[model samples]
Target: MLILGIETSCDETAAAVVADGRTILSEVTLSQDLHNLYGGVVPELASREHTRTLVPVVREAISEAEISYDDLEGIAVTNGPGLVGALLVGLSFAKALSYSLNKPLVGINHLEAHIFSVLLERPELVPPFLCLIISGGHSNLYLVESLGRYRSIGSTRDDAAGEAFDKVAKLLGLGYPGGPAIDEVAKSGNRDFIKFPKARMKSGGYDFSFSGLKTAVAIYVSKLNEKELQKRRADIAASFQEAVVGALLDNTIAAAEEHRMARIAVCGGVASNSRLRERLKASSETQGLLVFYPSLELCTDNAAMVAAAGNFRLENFPPDDLELDAFPYLELGD
Candidate 1:
C-alpha cells in the first residue's frame, strides 16, 4: 500500500510517502528554528508554523515520491500526545485530503510511531522485545509483544530524560535542544568527575524519576562561581549525561531481562544521543542480547514512522471517520 503520512506533533512539520510500511519513497520535514530563541518549543508558534509549512512539505514529499494524491492508498497522521494545536494542523489537513481523495485515514499514536520507527530500517527485526522511547516530551519503556500489541513496563514520574537534559543544559548556559549540546561537550569531559544522583524508585518497579537529578544539577551549578562553572561545565555535562543514561539503561535492561526478551529497540529523539547508543550497544554485547535503533534522522519525529504505523493500523483496524480529533495527552496503552 502507498500511504501519505503527516506529522505535526510538536515543532516539526513533516510529511512522507511510504510504500507497504517499510520503504520510504520520500520524506520532508520543516523544523521551526524559532523555538531555539525561546530555548524550547512555543505551542502557538509551533501550530502557526505548521499551518504555514505543512502544505508545502506534503506537496514536496509527494512530488519527490514521484506520485500524486490520486495515487495514495491511505492517509495517516499523528493525532495525539502532543501539542494539541500543532497536532490539529496536521490532522485537519490529513482529514481533508482523506475526504477529498476518498482514501483510508488512520490516526496514529505519536509514541507508537516512535516504536515502529526502527522497522523502517530494520524490517527484519521481529518484536517480542523491549523498546525505550525517550524524547523531550516522554520517557517510556514497553515490551513489544508484537506489532499493535504493547505492554508498558515503566515511564518517567517527573521530567523526561530529554527534558532534564534541556533544563540542565540551560542551567549550564548551554543552548536549547540540550541533548546534542551536552552529548558533544561531554565527549571531552570526565563522566566520573562528579557524582550525580540517579533516582531509584522506592517501589522498585521498572519506573524512572529524573526530577531529583535535574534539581541536583541545578543546585550544583548554583554553588559555582562563574569561573568555576566555566572550568567545570564540560565535566558537569558529562556527569549529568551519565546519570540520565544510567537511569534509562538500567530500567530498560531490567525490564527486558525480567520479561526474558533478548532483543531491544530504542527510538525517539533522545535515542540519537551518542552515550545512550554507545552504552546500549556495549551492554548488548556483554549481556548476550541485541539492540536496535533507527538511523539518527529517523530517531527524531518524522512522517515516515507515522506512515509505517498507519499502514499497520489501516490493515488491522477500521479507518477513522473525519470526526477524528487530535489528542494532546494520548498514551500508548490507551
Candidate 2:
C-alpha cells in the first residue's frame, strides 16, 4: 500500500511516500534556515515556516515518487509531542488531504516515529527489543514489545541530551544543532580533560537527568579565563560529550540487563552523535546484544520515519477519522 506521511513536529517541514512501510519512494524535508541564526528554534517562526513549506514539500515528495493521490491507500501525520503551532500546520494539512481523498487517516506520535526509524532502515527488525531515544526535546528508554506497543523504561527528568549539547554549544559560541559541532571539535581533545558529573538519580529508576550536567558545564566555563577558555575549547567539548554519552550508555545498558533483553536500538537526533553511536556499538558487542540505529539522515525529524510509523499503525491499530487533532504533549503509551 502507498502511504503518505507528513511531519512538522519541529523546525523541519517534511513529507514522504512509503510503500508497505519498508520502501521509501521519496522523502523531502524543507529545513528552516531562519532558525540557525537564533542558535535555537523559535516556536512562532517554526510554525510559520511549516505553513509556508508544507504544500511545496508534499508536492515535491509525491512528484518525486511519481505517484498520484489516487494511489495512496492512507494519509498519516504527526499529531503531537511537539510545538503546538508547528504540529497544527501539518495536522490541518493532512486532515484536509485525507478528507478530500476519502481515505484513512492515522495520527502518529512523534516519539514513536523515532523508534520506527530503525524499522525503516532494517526491514527485518522486529520488536521485543529495547530502545534508547535521545533527541532535542526528549530522552527516553522504551521496552518495545511490538509495533505500537511500548512501555517507558527510562526518561529524562530535566533537559534532554540534545538540548544539553545545544546549550553547551551556545555557551561556547558554537552554532545551532550543537551535536555535530561539539562532536567535531571533541575529536582533537581529551575526553578526560575535566570530570563532568554523570547524574544518577537516587530513586534508582530508569529515568535520566541532564540539566545538572548542563549547569555544571556552564559553571566550569564561567570560571575559565579568556585564554584558558580559548585553549581548552576542544577539551571542554570532549569532556562534556563524554559525560553525556556515558550517562546514556550506563542507563541503557542497565535497562537492557534489568529487562533481560538481548536486542537494543538507539534513535532520535542525539543518536546521530558519532561518539554515542560508537559507544553504543561497543557496549552492545560486549553485552552480547544486537544494536540497531536508523540511517544518519533518518536520525532527525523527517517524513520517512513518520511514514514508516504510520504504516506500522495502519497494520496494527483500528482506523481513524478525520476528526483526529494535533496534540502538543501526547504521551506514547497513552
- Top lDDT hit: 1
Q: lDDT per residue, candidate 1, 1-334, as tens digits?
A: 8999999999999999999999999989888989988888899999999998988999999999999889999999999999999999999999998998999999999999998799878977898888999999999999888898888889999998889988998998899999999999999989999999989999888888999999999999999999999999999999999999999999988888889989999999899999988998899899998888999999989999999999999989999998999889898872
Q: Which stretches in model 1 have alpha-carbon errors above 4 Å? A: none
As for candidate 2, its clashing pairs are none
**What are the per-residue Cα lDDT tens digits for candidate 2 across 1-334?**
6899999998999999999988999999888979879999999999998988888999999999999999999888999899999999999999989999998899999999998889888866788999988999999999998777899978899998999999999987789989899999999999999999999899997899989989999999999988988999999999999999999999999999999999888999898899988888888888898988898889889999889889988887876786888888888862
- Give the Å shift of residue 127 in candidate 1: 1.7
TM-score of each: 0.98, 0.98
Write down the lDDT that model 2 would get: 0.90
Per-candidate total of colliding backbone pairs: 0, 0
The CA root-mean-square deviation of candidate 2, after full C-alpha superposition on the true structure, stands at 1.0
Q: How does residue 149 of candidate 2 score in lDDT?
A: 84
Off by over 4 Å in 2: none
Q: Give the number of the best model, judged by TM-score.
A: 1
